[model samples]
Structures are given as structure tokens and as C-alpha cells.
Target: MNRRHFLQLLATLGVAGCWGSYKAYATTSSAKARVLIIGGGAAGLSMAARLNSVLETPDITLIDPSNEQFYQPGFTMIAGGIYSPDEVKKPQSACIPSGVKWVKEKVVSIDPVTSKVKASDGNTYVYDFLVLTPGLQMNFDQVEGISRSTLGVGNAHCMYDYQGAQNTWKALQEFSQKGGAGVFTNTFTKLKCGGAPKKITMLTDDYCRRNKTRDKISVTYYNASKDLFDTPYYAGRLEEIFKERDLNICPQHRLTGVDTASKKV
Candidate 1:
């Protein structure tokens, strides 16, 4: 759905006060069903909001470590030098519903039998229902000879996070000045946003062209996917753009390792 339609749906659903009835469910002596949500990311918060709207005063608790709520899609723009760090970040308090209890802690372990979760802060919470929305973990170490520290410093970099996006912007700026070839690689992992990798690459290419250093710098895209884009229509458009710009595209090549010393990604 488009942004306007989505916002209209949210408004129609009374998202703001939808959780008032859920609070009643918590206070009612009938069952006192406790709902525990793991992870305060988009999925977790969205689930919490919807449940609150359906049930009256529902007993729900959201657990997460970070205090800031990030709009991940904006990271691509940040890497493109279109947005600042502050513009993409929001206080967690602002995104979370008012009635739900916000727990600032990390989940250490889950005892499914007892319906309890242990936190890193030496506390445990019990729940009648559990929702797991903790986002997937990125294993940069899986790449041979590449450490987590190699990103943004060495030849390797990714724009998956805010800090990483900022680092990518810096890397692009530096690369523009030095006029060297760079490789942007994307694996076939289940990433949050599939289009983000190419978006950043295209933005970097645009940046180089704008700075009149396009000839000095060559950006190659190594995507593990079978096609540049999944959808046929979008793929055709991308193919046309790539051909028009003469951007190097490598399809179906997975990233194995980064040769930092040789700068061969």
C-alpha cells in the first residue's frame, strides 16, 4: 500500500487509543493473560499496537535494548548523503504505544515450558502468550578473512545500520577524492530491505558522477541473486539504467571473502 493509504488505514483503526480496551484485559480477574513480546523493532511494535487495539487493556510488555527507534529504510538515504543521523532516528518512547509497558533489557534465555523469559538484567517475566520478533543477526564473521571491524575501515563496508551508513557515506566521500575502483557486494541472505544494497551503490555512482570523478572511479555490483532485481518490470528498468550508465553488474556471484590488502572485494 502507498504511504497515504497506509496512514489512512491506521487512522481508521483508531491506533492511538486502540489499546485502552486491552488494559481492561490486564485488570480483569478472569485470566490476566500476560503477553510478552520479544524485540521492539517494527514487527514487535506493530504486533503490540494491533493487539492493544483489539483487546481492552491487554497486558503486554515490549523488551528491547536500544532506546532509539530507527527507520531502517532511511539508512539508504543517509548513505546517499540525503539524510543525517538525527533525521532517521526517533526516541523509542515516541514509537511505542503509551499504555504498553516498555522494558529496556536484553533477553538472555527463554523457558518455553514455564512461559517465562530471563533478561540480562537479572529479572524474569512470565507470560501466557509470547511473540518473538527479534530481528535476525548478521554474521559478518561468516565471510572468510573478514572481521566485524573490517567494515567501514578496510575495503569492506555495509549500510545496514545507521553507524554503518554514516561510515559508508564517509567511505564514498573518501573514494571520490582518491578515485579508485570499489566493489559493492550483496549476498542472498534474508535482509530486511532487498533493494537497499543497490540503492546505495547507485547513489554512490551518482555521487561520483556529480563530482566529475566518474571516470576515475569504477563501481561494480556483485549480487548473489539471479537477476539485478526480482520483479521483471523493475529488473527491466534497472537493466536499462545500468546499460545507460555503463555500470558493471555481476549477477549470481556470492561474496566469499574480502581481500583487504589488495582491495579486491
Candidate 2:
């Protein structure tokens, strides 16, 4: 069944718990609890907002080292030339909800037994409740011959970071004009947005098509799993679309390293 029909079925069975069906029941609490939240990203900030709405006198303190907040989902669109770098970031101070304390410090260590957290500023914070929402980290060192500094150096670009996204946009423009082979890959491990690799690959294909250079450009997609998408409903359709678009799909292959000197992976 299609997604819409499946969701309809869920609603009929009274199990539809989608975001659209969610209703917030805001009620202020009298407890003056000190809540310490680690990280200032979307998850942390959103949680703080919810708590602030539900607590009459919220004592929420958010700790993060970054001075700027990034809209990470926009990175892929930025690489696709749809969003500029400036549009994806804003000062972290502007994102922190009012009535919430912002601690501009990196968390060094957490001592759960003592209910305290040691920050980089050589200060310890005590909290009645702790919320950890620290985001994921990208380890370029794990991949041999490719480091963060080497991105965009040899047509090697990624959309996971701000600079990398801009570099990818630059490389894509050159590639679209030069009309060469383009390869897209994904890791075997779970990603924050696992469909990003496929999305960017399709975006490149679309971009080349719009530029009227698709025929000269060969597109190959390497996936580390057995299927392009784990969901059978969409996987079958995606494979069909890839075939129709002349996009090569190779499954069960993981990219371990890159040989930028010889243009090999």
C-alpha cells in the first residue's frame, strides 16, 4: 500500500501517532528544578522550548561551545546550489529561547554519581536533572588519505559540514560543465539522515540534466547496504527510477579511503 493509504489505515485503527496528529497540552509546573541541558543544536533547543512552556519558572541552562547554530538539513540543499552558506547559520545567542540560561562552554566530563558536570571553563555545574543532546561527530581521520583539511582539494567534497557543502557546490559546477564521471557513496553505519547520499546523487543528476550535460556525465552510486532504501515500498520504486535515469547503483560497498592523487577510491 502507498504511504497515504498506510497512514489512513493507522488512523482507522486509532494508532496514528504522526506529528500532524500531535497536540500539545501546556501546563505550568510549580517545581523550581534546575535543569542542565548539554548541546545547543535543534534537539537541545527544542527540548528547552518545550520545558520552558511547561514550567512557570523554568531554570534551564543550556551548555554548548559553538557561537553559531547551523541548520544541518540545509547543507545538502546548499551543496545542490539551492541554499547559500549564510542562509544556513545564525548566531547561537539568537536561537536560545528567552528565560533559558546559555552557558558558552564545552562539556569536559559528566559525573552522574555526583550529579555534576565539569565544563571546559574549569567550572562545575550541579543540576536537578540533566539532558544530554550532544550531536554526532564526523571522524575524517578514520578514512585513510582523506582528512577534513583535504576536502575540496581533489574533487573530494562532503555536505556534512559548512565548508564542505560550499566546496561541493563549487566542485559540482565545475563537474557539470566539464562532464566527467561522478561517484556518490555512503557509509555502512547509520547516519543522521541516511537518505542524504541518495538525495545528493539525484540532485547532481537533475542539475546536470538541467544544464543539458547529463548525456556526457556518467553517474554511479555506491551504497553500503543491500538495498538503496530499507523500506521495500520505496526501494522498488527508487530502483526503477534509477534505471530509467541511467544511474548505476552498486550495493554492499563501503568507501574506506580515497586516492585523490590518481582520482581513485
Backbone clashes (count) for model 2: 0
The Cα error of candidate 2 at residue 217, in Å, is 0.9
Candidate 2 Cα RMSD (Å): 7.1
Residue 196 lDDT in candidate 1: 91
Worst 10-residue lDDT window, candidate 2:
18-27
lDDT of 2 by residue, 201-258 (tens): 9889999999998988999999899999999999999999899899999999989999
What are the C-alpha RMSDs, in order, of all predicted structures?
7.0, 7.1
For model 1, the stretches where C-alpha displacement exceeds 4 angstroms are 1-32
TM-score of each: 0.84, 0.90
Candidate 1, residues 55-126: lDDT per residue as tens digits?
Answer: 555788999988999999999999899999899899999999878999999999999999899998989999
Q: What C-alpha lDDT values do all the predictions have?
A: 0.80, 0.84
- Steric clash pairs (candidate 2): none
